[model samples]
Target: MNYDRILAARTSRIKASAIRELLKLAANPDLISLGGGLPSPESFPLDLVMELTEKVINKYGSAALQYDTTEGFTPLRKALVEYINAKGIDAGLENIYITSGSQGFLDAIGKLLITPGDYVAVEGPTYLAALQAFNAYEVHYAQMQVDKEGVIPESMEEIIQSYPVKFVYTVPTFQNPSGKTIGVQRREKIAEIILKHDVLLIEDDPYSALRYKGEELPTIKSMAPDNVIYASTFSKIFAPGLRIGFFVAPEKLGRWLVLIKQGVDLNTCTFTQALATEYLTGGYVSKQVQKNINLYRPKLETMLKELEDNFPKDFKWCEPDGGMFLWVEGPEGMDMEKVYKRAIEKGVGFVPGTFFFPNPGDGIETMRLNFTNIAEEQIKQAIKILASVVEEEMKITSIN
Candidate 1:
C-alpha cells in the first residue's frame, strides 16, 4: 500500500515505548517484572472504588456518562485547587486543566510548544515517555546531570546557557524510574534558574503523594507558579485504568491547553472525573495514601536490603525517600541490555538504563528496578537473579 509515502513525517520520530514493549514480554505468567512503574494491586481501594463508581452512576447518572468541558469537570478542578493548595501551592480553577492522563499533558505540551529541531533540556536519565513525546515533535535534547538527588541545577543552568532550549522538563519529586526527589533548596535554585532564563518548566509529579519517608517539600510550582506547568495524575493515588490527570499553568497557557485538549479528546472521562471528585472530597486520597505507604514501604525496604546483601561491591544504588523504583549503576562499560537479556532468561524482567538516556549509547552501565508491583518474595528472587546476571557479566568482562 506504500503507507510510508502517505504518512506524516512527524510519525517517524515516535517509537514504541521501551517499558510497554517489555511489559508485553512480562505477560508470561512465570515472569517476575521489576520493569513497569505499576502501583501494587494491594494499594488500590478496590471496594471503595466500586462503591464510588456506583454512587457516581446513581447520583450523577447521565451527567457522569455524558460529555463535559475540556477544562475538566468543574468539581474535580475545584477539588484539585484545594488539594495542591494544602501543600503550599496557590491554584485557582482558572489555573487548572485536565486531560486523559499526565501522558496527554506531555503530548499536548509537545504539540503546543515544540518546533521541529528546537531544544528541550532534560535530565540525562529522564522519563522515557516524555522524551518520546517531545521526540515526536522532532525536538532536540540537551542532557543534564543527575545524582542521588535528581537533576543538578548547575548542570541544567549550563545546558540552558549553551543551547537554544525552548523549555525545561523535570520529574522533580519521587521521579519516575530514578526514584529521586530534588530537595527543597535545589528546587528553589532550579526555579530561580528557570526564571532567569525565561524558559518554561514542566514539573511532571505523579509520585509525591506516595511518600514513604521524610517531610513533604514545597512544589516547584509553588515557588515559581508563573514559569512551571505542573502535571500530576490520579493513577498512583487511585487507579490507572480510569486515567484522569491534572495540570496547573498560567491563565493564557491554561486556556490554550483547554482549547488544545478540546481538539484532542473534548475532555477527560466524566465518569472518572466524578469519581475523582468524590474520592478527593470524601478524603479517600489521604487514607489511601497512608495505606499505599504501608503496603509499598516494606517492599522497597526488602529490595534495598536484598541489593545490599547480594549485589557486587562495585554495583551501586541509593535508597530513595519514596517511590516505586531504584536506579542501579553497574561498572562503566557494562552492557545492561545484555544483563537484561540474561535476567529475563531466568524469568526476571526489568528496564535497562539505556532506554531513558537523552543521548544514544549512554547509560550502558545502568538499569531501573521497580519494586511496588512485584510481591516482596518475588522482588527478593528478582534481585538475586539480576545480581547473578550482573556478576556473570562482570566475570565475562574480566575474562575479555
Candidate 2:
C-alpha cells in the first residue's frame, strides 16, 4: 500500500489549493459562500446553447464528437482570430492552439519551460491555479511586486535583472485573487522590458471581457506580440463546464505547444470548440457578456456598500472595477485561518488569502471575496457575518 517510494519526486512540489479546499465547504447549502469565483447561472445563455448544440450536431455531425487535431478545430481557430483581433490582439490561426481550458495551457507551459529549480517570476499574490500548475514541474519562484495597480512593471524589470527566471507569468487584466488590472501605460513598459530582456511573458486574460466598470486596456500581447503568449478562456464568458480555452503564442512556440498538447489531451473538445465557434461568429459572446456584467455589477456594489457600513474602520479592501473577486486586508497580526473557522461557524465562507502568495506566511491578514455567484441578499448577509468575524479576530489579536 505504501506508494511514497514509487511516486515521482515532482509530486512532492504539489500541494492542495486553499481555494479548492474552501470549495468543498462552500458546497454546503447551509453556508453563504463568497469563496469560488463562479459565474452567475442567471447569465448563462442556456437557450442559445441549446440552439447552438443542435446546429453543431446537425452541421458538424461526427466531427463534433470525434478526437480533433492538436491544432484545434479550424473553424474555432478562425473564429478566435477574429475574436482576438476584436480584442485588439492581432493573431492568425497559426498562432493559436486550443486546450482543455486555460489551466491546460498553464500545465503545457510548465512542461515546455520549467525544469527542476528553474525560476518563474510571478506576482506576490498571483493566480493560485497557475502556482499549482507550475509546482508540478518542480519550479521555484521569484515573487514580483503587486500594488493597487496589480503587477508592477518596475518590480518585474527589477526581478528580471537579478533573477534568472525562465519567463514572467501574469494575470494582468482583472487579475484573479486581487482583481487588479495593470494600467495601459504600465503594460507598455512591461512589454518593453520583456522585449529588451527577450524573455517569455505569459499574459493570462480570462477575466478581461468580464469588465463591469472602467475603460478597457490594451493587452500586453498587442504591445509585444512576438514575445508574449496570451492565455484566455470561455469559462468566464460562457460556461466553465464546457472546458474550452486557448493560448496564442508566436509561430515557433505555438507549434511547440501543439506538439505538447498532442501528448496531453490530443486536443480540446471538438464539440465544445464547435459551440464556441458559434458563440463567437454567431455574435452571442458580446450579448451574453453584457448580460453577465448586468448580473454581477450589483452584487459587487452591494458587497462594497455592506463592507463600508459594517467592517471595522482600519480593515482595508479595494473596489475592483471588474472581475469576480476582490482583496481585503484585515487589521495587522490577524491570522485569516482562524478567522475562516469563525466565518464558517457563522454560516459563511471565504478563501484565506495566504494561499495566493508564493510563500505561506505572507498575506496572513488578507482574504479574497467573490461576488459573482451569490445573490444580493446572501452577499449582504455573508459580508455582515464576515465583517463581524474580521472585527472579532482583530480584537482578539490586539488583546493578546
Which ten contiguous residues of candidate 2 have the minimum total lDDT? 15-24
Off by over 4 Å in 1: 16-27
Residue pairs whose backbone atoms clash in candidate 2: none
Candidate 2 local lDDT, 157-199, one digit each (tens)? 9999998989999999878898888998899999999999999
Name the runs in model 2 displaced over 4 angstroms.
Answer: 16-27
So what's the TM-score on candidate 2?
A: 0.97
User: What would the C-alpha RMSD of candidate 2 be, to one decimal place?
Assistant: 1.4
lDDT string, candidate 1, 71-148, tens digits: 999989999999978978888999988889899999999989989999999997899989988888999999999878
lDDT of 2: 0.89
